[model samples]
Target: MNSKKSKYHLLVLMDLSKASEAALKNAVHLAKEINGKVEVFHVKSPADVAKYENQFSAMRAIQEDTSNVQSKLMKLIREIEKEEKVVITLQISYGNAKQAIKDKIDSVKPDLVILGKRKNNLMNFLEPDITKFVLKECNANILISGEDNKFHSFDDISLGVYGETIHKEGLEIISDLKTNEEDPIRFFRIRNPNNSDKSVTTEQNKKWAVSYTFSEGENALDGLASYITGTNTQLFCIPRKQNENASWFGLSRINDLIYKLNIPVLILR
Candidate 1:
């Protein structure tokens, strides 16, 4: 195992929406617990500014507009900094939200990136694409949050394990988290009935807090969804196995559940 001090710097994507607000709060909670700094990021499109240029002075409006948003965020950052003494910074950029974030990820090199799940039903089809884009592009760890996830400590962590071989990377990442000895870590062995491996029983021998369940045929994704919901899992981890079926981590049913889970899904590569 690699040994090094763990230092966390978080970058949270915020558009000032309700869902973004929730994502920011969750990021703050984690930062406070870890004594880490946070960067509140916002992206604007040039076309958006041009659309309103005729009505308002472009330069003045842009500065005033960004300042208004920054002022509110800075106020919140100050309060959190004063109360928890954690450092927080604001970053604003122009262009596509997804691309802007990717660039920021390269420049800032954040340990973890927190993004809000799209809450608009009308744009449901488009939202998952952005999530998939980020998952594929960003190299650092990711935490996807929905509006329902409020500011709370991560007391329970659930690791969705396919079998023994594929989840070793995830275990390594989990070992690095700043977790107390008593914090419960649940290892969920999601078995496929067709496969006779049944590694769950063998895995149980290695850990005390292990749970096993088989995926219901055709309804496997729903079954796992219900499991996460019942567990009220604070942080859910899954492996992003490459060249796998959609069930593994592709842009399909599992992707759908990733957005619907309402909790942070930490993708482990």
Candidate 2:
């Protein structure tokens, strides 16, 4: 845990879309609570301009469009500033959306990158979704906001421990949260439901509130959701495996959990 990097820099990836608004609102509230700065970047693909060159001969039209995006971003900043104590910055780039975002993440070195998980469609297949790409590429932490337009507090956090790798990183991240006496950590473990004869024991030192469930259904998301809804957890923490393809302890469980749970998710890499 790096206590020296207490102050967080939050980058909100936006496109002035409805989903982006929800993400930005949640991010602004979080930034205010953490006393962090907020930056919003809108990405415009240069390929789009090239493809439309026949219809619009002037390159100035594309430049004006980029400028308009920056103006809109500033307006959003002003609106959020009225309600929260955040220093907002705006950026606009013309290139690949994912690459532009990655570049910004590298240059700004933000503590966390906030983004909205958009629906996947055929048109977006080749260009892969930015959120998914960020998960694979960026070294910085990520928070994927859902359609639910609400603010969340990390008063009660749940750690979905399945293996040693996730367990170790989860514990470290939870410790770094600096939870007060009022708030404590909660733990949950998933196992086969049919193994009634088998039992998983939790260490006493790391024990807080522990629950075990047999994942009777094939869907791992259901098992995790049962715990989340049953316990009303605020944040869910999981670890990313070093190997991208292998799933020794079911790393895909995190992806399922992310898609099902509406709350903030922490993926420790």
Candidate 3:
């Protein structure tokens, strides 16, 4: 299934961070490319009632908190929609952050989910392992942006091939967002001590996109990261390793790159 369709529905998670705002802008730019609609989702963590002096104070604070968060979100949505000339909607949720995000994903069933990744801390700029959970479990593909405020232009994409072969399904999904036919996706594989086969891929690979390889005696993930940085890739795409190939590169390695790489990362699921 090439899934070479016309439009898409993109859901962007917004937490009022600089990175998240960037994600929303990038998502808007992407929606323009894919002819997609955008949904800006925000999760307001419940105020700490325990910290309040009494129940009355807690109740008052909670009410104020909701109003502030909602007002800010609405303002943002309106500005982006008006400035970009794109129809966008906003969804706000309460309670647990991770659970709220998961619920939204299930309800929206979007074609793609855009979220932000800040390099300021390691625990989680969003929540505990929320990014990891979504990348591992979500059915739709995820586009993660760093603090870079510049609108992401998916002009030059770098796809990392795990083995001699690449994930065709993932490629098809990414191809749907290729608005510019002038620039083709560049797919590459790193040959090292563990996995090294100089054999060429089939003609089918050529039909999909251009292929490249890098010989690195060092770590494979590091090599892949270097290639993306050197090429000035706007977006980096990697396959979502199913259970069968989970051990190939492990998800933790991807998480470690949160603060390291500033470009948008596409975990093609």
TM-score of each: 0.78, 0.76, 0.81
Candidate 2 weakest lDDT stretch, 10 residues: 119-128
For candidate 1, list the clashing residue pairs, or say none. none
Q: Candidate 1: deviation at residue 243, Å?
A: 9.0
Clashing pairs in 3: none
Best by lDDT: 3
Off by over 4 Å in 3: 1-6, 49-57, 120-128, 155-168, 179-182, 191-208, 214-218, 242-246
Better of 1 and 3 by lDDT: 3
Evaluated against the true structure, the overall lDDT of model 3 is 0.67
Q: Evaluate model 1: give its TM-score.
A: 0.78
Residue 6 accuracy (lDDT) in model 2 = 38
**What does candidate 2's lDDT look like per residue over 66-160, in tens digits?**
77777777887787777664557787788778788889999998877887655421112125466667777898767776546565553333444
* Model 1: per-residue Cα lDDT over 35-145, one tens digit each: 456788877776666556365576667777778878887777787668665566798777776788789899888878887765532112123366677778888777777
Compute the lDDT of residue 133 as modeled in candidate 1. Answer: 71
- For 1-269, candidate 3 gives per-residue lDDT tens digits of 12344377899888877778888989888777666888888776655322587888877877887788779878887888888877778877767877787888888788789888666443253476777778767787788875667877654344434434446656555665554545645665654445535553423435545566666444656766676677666666666743333564567766655445677777766
